[model samples]
Target chain A: MDVSNLGLIDFHAAYAIQERLVAQVASGEAPETLLLLEHPPVYTIGSGGSEANVLDPAISVVRTNRGGDVTWHGPGQLVGYPVIDLGRRGRDLHRYLRFLEELSIRVAGEFGVAARRVPGKTGIWTDRGKLASIGVGVRRWVAMHGFALNVAPDLEPFARINPCGMAGCPVTSLAREADAEPTVAEVAARVECLFPHLLNELLPCETETEGGRHVCCRLQVARGKAPLDVR
Target chain B: MATEITMPKLSDTMTEGRLISWKKGVGEQVNRGDIIAEVETDKANMELEAFTSGVLLETRVTPGELVPVGTVIGIVGAAGEAVAAAPVAVVPEPAVTETAAAAETAPAPAPEEPPPVHLSVAGEEAVKASPAVRRLARELGIDLQTVQGTGPDGRVLQEDLERLGGAGVTVAEPAAQPAVAETAPVAGTEPAAPRTELHDALPLSRMRSAIAQNVSTSWRTTPHFSVTVEIVMDAAAEVVRELREGGTPVSYNDLIVKACAMALFRFPQLNNSFAGDGIRMNADVNIGVAVGLPEGLLIPVVRECQRLSLREIAAESRRLAERARTGSISQQEISGGTFTISNLGMYGVDEFASIILPPQAAILAVGAVADRPVVRDGSVVAAKTMRATLSADHRIVDGLYVAQFLGEVKRLLENPVLMLV
Candidate 1:
């Protein structure tokens, strides 16, 4: 699997870029691309989520076509967008979410964050607070939008919306947990390292890339784009 | 005398709305302000008011179709009025003036061959359940057709699903062989005959599924820690007894709800929900009173509980509880609750923890109010007391906040007169 990592930026710019990429993927133009970015303090509602959960209407609330309820996103948060053909990678949304959650938990563990999955939720949480949020939109079995891990985000904006329909869970950041702020880029690199192991475990065909240092998998193809090769 | 019924704009941002369903069909006599149709706006679903008191002449928009605001959805007129002669026109393009003149002057073209009536077999004979139940079922991954509905017309009810047995059946059925083996008696020398079951296995009802999903989700996702507080309800019981003797029967649950509501005013954070990122302090103090019905528990909210007096809370709660029990509550009553209170006092429960309702940070579980010996002013006295527990999602509420919130509830309940003022 070919894994691509992007940088953090404002929510609208990131959303626009993701939207453009989605359109291309939907139009059968661009290869399946996983664009990672961050938002600058915003709340987004999922397909069937209620606006009532959004307590502060003055803040930006972007209505998204994702599965799950409303959640918050902001700067210092590592948001990963996996634009993969679910058909090519075994159309299992639950499996995909589990993998992302596992990866986040692993990443949080690297920093001694002690992150784990809440018994019935789809996100990763630390003993103190929620470390990451997950919401995805799958179009024609192709997945887009992904998890947002609080790296060093100012959690004040989370108060504006009911994150993932859980009204009162306080958002936490890796920086807050570590008691020292680490740039999202540094966290993202650490997270990217776990991707290879996750890809090999999740996908069937695995291969070594970059002088056998990293493992990768070439997913089966259907019609639109090249199979995702994650390393 | 055709009275055109256009879709009224429910919200400021609503340019177009989808007609969910028409409660009253064509030719149905409707009074003014009756909910003839349900419209889904951008923000929420709202009822379409029937401003005209007359017979519904015709329906212009089908359910589930989106139409612009002010679109002529239907027309009303006196019985026997020829409303069919009225010109049909879209809201933006009003062709009625010219079309009406043309119709009056020119003989109507022989009605084009009557179109074939296409009836949906899928819709006909399909199960009839409330939308909330269906939504709950879909979330819980339960098949509605399986549940044996006990509601009117065999409608699978939310309460029915909320029942402990109902949820146990759905949750345990997947591993039924193991469950049965564990619970059943050991086989004798002669293999025990399979338990005779008269009923067929049914799918989980939507409400049951939702309850399962929510309860399991809350338990699994949040690191829930509960703190119990014992309130000396001697004052509260006296107030209730006095009220009842004065011809105003009020429940202890009503007093608890009022006390909690008042406590929330002091600790607004308790009125919040866990929005994964942070706490969202709700603006309204709508209190969801958890009512135990045959199926399960339903928390019908008593909106603005802080504003209403104890008497008002009792009256409104009684009404809502009755409506919920009868399954006649309007959609409005079931939604928009900011906080919830669950009472198992009547069930003789000393104390029990409750799952936090999503979006709300905490839920107050009221145990039975009973007579207990307590030390008051250096003397042991038998006093009426009730045990209550507050379950808080650690992510949103800290230990101190929970303690403070519970303390306030204790103060208000101990001094019932303060709540009245």
Candidate 2:
């Protein structure tokens, strides 16, 4: 996994860059790339999401191809764009999802946010409010458009939309919880460090790539090395 | 006669469903129960079955399209029967055009001359554009609506908004404007801060909102009281061991479900639902086993549990659980339950209470069965015991009734062989 740290940018511009990058990887034009970005404050609706949940029409709403309903993104938020080749790592979306949740929980603890996964919900949430949101899109076994962690950005924008299609659950920021403002760059670095360990733990040891420098790795089952033999 | 295939409510909270795929295209013959399309609800992906056997005349919406609860997605009618001319298209045009004309004339006055002045504010005074283009430009925060379009009559379709970098337009008021924060003046000479709009506003997802409503209503409407009982599972555990030794594997939940079912036979009123006018005792003991799904909890009923054997109950529970996890359980599988059970035993929870499912007067919550030291015959002894709580709606059943009901359950669970009989 190649990590590129991008500072805060406009939501539309970030999405445009993501589309180009995903297309490039799909055409084998670029090696798997993960572009980390923070947005200027916007609400997005996924493929099956409804615009009706957006209470404020003034805010820009971008409909994207992902698996969840409506979610908010804005300044003071840390958004990770993971463009890794899952084919190189076993194509287990479930395990990948679990890794994402674990990474969020770990990063949240550093800021004393006390985040945990809601039993059936896919994101990390606190008792009073949600701290982070996760929605992903995969193409050709490569993942893109990952989780968003609320840092210091004004969460007032979240009130305008039913965040993640869930109502009554207020969105919270780390700054609000920690009572200290933290830059997006600071949070992204912590997240990048936390994700690789989780990825390695879930993937088989043989699947680890060369030198473990590049996170993308694939393993072919050896005859005797099979964990279990049916015969 | 033409039969309109409206969007069916796939779940209790689903008011609309997205057509994932049209399995049967237009002009194809379809029989009753034939899956014409796959509808993705908030909770799961469900197959839309044809309720009437006929030729699929027309598909109103394509795959990836969504329609409201009463919106017709397809038309089914006899062969050679002329389907009703897509009624939706005919209905919306006249009304929509009328409203569009009214909106154009009404809102044009207040912001009529402000566009030119607004264009100058953003440093783009030379641009000239139509009202529609101006509206799009304003929405994209673009002031370049003055750029001339090459389309017939210079009409803007969505691309023009994208081409302008979505900048330089001061036209219509922003739709769904965020609440503007009032900024205090830093100094007497300094201008007040620009009205900063905060937060992304969105509509509530029907499913999530419904869940909230149901939970709150359950707490408010039901005067619920819970009773916890510890069942010494030495006999039940031995019974399970013997059964496993005989090549029959069963879970503790299987025994609990069976025990609850057998106990319901003794106190039939406990196996009843609160009808609007009066209490309705169920003829059969159909127990709903709650299974947690990826999106939420779904309880699939094991119908006629009183007639099924332990092995049969185990098989049914396993089948229902697999179906719930795979998102393939039918509507009937979730409907028609007289009682429900939720288990947190695997999580090592020693005791917990559950909310009563609507219409069903009570629910049983099972916790971990563990070995604990207890005073047996006035001496301390390590005994295997499981804690179970029964939450009942007090409006429908009294404390004495619930006590008696719990007693019957305790007897059946303590005497494990009684369940088999």
TM-score of candidate 1 to 2 decimals? 0.41
Could you give candidate 1's per-residue lDDT for residues B249-268 as a string of tens digits? 89899899899989999888
List, residue by residue over B191-243, the lDDT tens digit for candidate 2: 66554232232323433444555667678877889988888888889999999
Candidate 1: segments with Cα more than 4 A from true spot? A1-231, B1-202
Instruction: For candidate 2, give the lDDT of residue A72.
Output: 82
Cα lDDT of all candidates, in order? 0.67, 0.67
lDDT of 1 by residue, A35-124 (tens): 667666667776556677788767657776565667877678888886765544543455566667877888888887877665346688
Q: How well does each candidate superpose onto the true structure, as a TM-score?
A: 0.41, 0.40
Candidate 2 whole-model C-alpha lDDT, 0 to 1: 0.67
